[model samples]
Target: MRLPCILVLFLGCGSPDQVQPEIKQLNEIPLNIRDKTEVDERTATVNDTLPEGWVDVKSLIPELVLDIRYATSDNFVGIQLYPCERCLLRKEVAEAIAVAFEALRADNLGLKLFDCYRPRSVQEALWRKVPDARYVTNPAKGSMHNRGAAVDLTLIDQNGHEIDMGTEYDFFGEKAYHTFTKLPAEVLTARRKLRDLMQEVGFKHIRTEWWHYSYQIKNYEVSDFRWPCPGQAL
Candidate 1:
């Protein structure tokens, strides 16, 4: 069954209450998408090595751009939090994102992922640095990212340059809020296009962050499993 659409409209007020209803609906929605374990079972014969419900997105969508900020020091933390640069998500979420990419590609646009499927341990470490819930969710409570069902990404143009979204990824401020509309007209248009496309593909946007989206059709537990780093002992 197809998931019910969750439309998020921003009024440029930066009020969390405006987005709370959608967030609440995310948990209340009945399961419409296939379970991750089921997907794992079906794909087991095709590729038996990957963990159930988890996939490296680049393998499924090769043309999609990946700039995993946490794997490098270019993020807000200014530290390499991840072991490597890879975009991993629950199998269903990955597939949905791949479809979104195809839609974007048809328009000569593309996606550039910043972060995905963050390990719970990493969340704890991040909390240690920034304990405030405004910026980092407490690891004890966990986040959609810990469940391999969330993504931080932005749109890229045909030339592969990231389209302006008012601020850079991981910018924790009012300026990063989807309701903040004092930016250039082009930036607003880019953000809306991305938001509309992602929501159409079963993803929901949070109020505070323009680049973050979480798949809502199914729920998964927070995980501590870390992806292997290149040339590093597991």
Candidate 2:
């Protein structure tokens, strides 16, 4: 159940649409989340201020709707959903992405943020879905997704069709491996383009998953403690 990144094929510059209704005020804890009360004690806390150069993407790529919610089988199983509203990353990360989008769009390309700023509580719920020692990270251990730093993303062409990245988002197998030798050269190049562009905008990708990247998570040694998402008025 990875977030939807379905690219649409179209053209011409158009004003961005209103953010999707289901995508906003995403504070309710889905019923299936494991322990709503369990909080990560070791999580780190940060100042409320956003760094410079980061711009909110709500208006930048409004055509690319966000579905940042729990998935029965999203990456890392179910542990990466936003646990609390405020607990997600500050808005600056989205801003940074918007800047990156502006640069990418100049070349007729666009970005699709599959996941961003997850709450630690949602990570706990994800653990319950697949508590296996191999696939999921224990909330007690911490997850990059729990921090505002990590994001799952992909690219879209001018026509809006998503460029093939060799496998579906959150495909949990060898095919999903960024280094899989079986992938074609062209697909690999497209993957690298997304990776390089994100990196240029100050993001770093995880070795196993090319679609996953981080902005500020590299500086923090721990995930953020569960909190709430930013207020709607923001």
lDDT of 1 by residue, 32-106 (tens): 223457544544533344467677777666678999988988876789989779888888788788777777766
Candidate 1 shows a clash count of 0
Q: Which residue window of length 10 is worst by lDDT in model 2?
A: 7-16
Please tell me which predicted candidate would have the highest lDDT against the true structure: 1
> Clashing residue pairs in candidate 1, if any?
none
- Quote model 2's TM-score: 0.61
Candidate 2 lDDT over residue span 134-203, tens digit each: 4445878776666566777788887777789998776667676655647788787787677556655556
TM-score of 1: 0.80
